[model samples]
Target: MAYRETVKIRDRKAAQREALLAAAEGLVREGGFAALTIQALSARAGVGVGTVYRYFRAKDTLAAEVFRLATEREVAAVAEALQHQTDAAAKLEQAASRFARRALRAPRLAWALIAEPVDPAVDTERLRYRAAYAALFEQMIEAGVRAGELPLQSPTLSAAALVGALAEALVGPLADHQADEHVVQQLIRFCLRAVGAADPTAPEVSHEQVC
Candidate 1:
């Protein structure tokens, strides 16, 4: 009986932690990290501030967790896009289009993930996820080169540049709350051109289908 009770307590604590994290992510989705205070999180989660502290020792810790959670979802979406298409160029296009469409769908969250001034912890997470994106692109670029879809070039550098281009291109528009398919198409074309892919025609990504 004691062992069963212990298991239940552990499960309950885990659920509570997940709830707090979910609330933290919601706050960021609506207002960015600046709005993710412990008090605010507790209020949103219907818990005491001390309860929040019990899960996360500091605001920076909490903010970093939120960043990690949000970035992982973004990365996974792009990864799925890359995996869905067989052609290397097509994979790159799909991944880029997916990223841009998702960003346009949630500009506030995108800005927070991309360019918002944040705590050191959150910034560290941002850099790590940037590398994660570059790694994904690098694999596609290498495959393109292998398949003769792209010219001979350094995949690592090209991948980093592509990631930078996508993020930088969206910064101004995302900040301004502008949702334009033209922008996403341009971004896809730009990435293909930069990688020296032939016939770089970018397909339209619908704002309605942004996931």
Candidate 2:
């Protein structure tokens, strides 16, 4: 009986934590990270301030979790989008387009995940996730070189540069809330040209799609 009761209590606590995180994310989306507060979050989440504190001791902790969750979703989406695409150039273009579409769909979440100041621990985790995504670009670049689609050179540097350029081009305007479909298409074209791909057009990845 005690074990069952403990399990139930644990489940309830987990649910409450999820609720608080969801509320915090919504608040950040509506405003910005500056608007996230324990009291505000507690009210938004329909939980007491003490309950919010139980889940997250500080605003920074909650903010970190929000970014972590958003980044994790992005990593998953990118991986999933690239999974079935076999061609190197196609994979790269698809990944870039999908990423842009996802960012456009969740502008606020994108800004919070990429532009907001986060704790060191969260930043380290984000870097690891980013590196994992970069590895896909590295693999695609190497494949392009091996297939003679691209010149045989430093694949790692080239991949890193391409990824960095695409990110910089796409994310700045997005963080500024000025990103649109046309801007995303232009960024995709730029990335494709930088990669030396034959085609610079992004195949129709829907805006609703998460990458």
Candidate 3:
């Protein structure tokens, strides 16, 4: 007889893999990335230590996978939020707002993904995801410039600046804890000004709306 796979066995294996990843994510959420070890992850997932190795070879690999998964999900969400908006400035506003809202709501996860010092392997993964985020802004900036909605500037550079500004502002102790609404607004306004996006809501010469 030829070798064949059973649906039941494949489903069970898939479920176990998901469980392991979930446990890794939970550990990072609760205690940051350093807390995710093979023994600790096995305990958290209610699986044997060997089982974790079956799914992932090392802690850094697992941690990097978790970061990729989370960031990919956020990318999809921001993309969806930007579907209805036509103007580049409005698209930038909505996209930045969506990213800021999620980061502010989950500060610990945000911190780990944004600025937590980790293995160089994981750092490489972080840079990849950050580039993914910058691409979103770059696309919007290009559209804006073609439409004459924004001044002529290097979209790639502007995108990188916006990504850095947003991540730093939300991640470290540099952030304020009160009034998420106010903070999100400030971040959006900064993004518009940085891109020279000409929106009616953008404060040109006022100190009040700048904050």
Best of the candidates, lDDT: 1
Q: For model 1, how many clashes?
A: 0
Q: For residues 1-211, what per-residue lDDT tens digits would candidate 1 score against the true structure? A: 9999999999999999999999999999899999999999999999999999999999999999999989999999999887778887788889989999999999999999999999999999999999999999999999889988889999999999999999999999999887589889778777877898743343453444332
RMSD to true structure for each model, in Å: 4.3, 5.1, 2.2
Q: Give each model a TM-score.
A: 0.93, 0.85, 0.91
**lDDT of each residue in 26-124, candidate 2, tens digit only:** 998877677788989988988789988888988878877887786778878887888877777777778888888888888876766665676675677
Error of 3 at 136 (Å): 1.0
lDDT of each candidate versus the true structure: 0.90, 0.77, 0.83
Residue by residue across 1-211, what tens digits does model 3's lDDT show?
Answer: 1234577777889998988888888888777787878999999988898989998998889988988888888888998988979999889889988998887777677778888789888899899988998998899898888889999999899989999998888764423345277888888887888898765565463786576
Residue-level error in angstroms, candidate 2, position 196: 1.6
In model 1, which range of ten residues has the least summed lDDT? 202-211
Order the candidates by lDDT, highest first: 1, 3, 2
Q: Which stretches of candidate 3 lie over 4 Å from their true place?
A: 1-5, 173-179, 200-205
**Highest TM-score among the candidates is held by which one?**
1
Clashes of each: 0, 0, 0
**What pairs collide in candidate 3?**
none
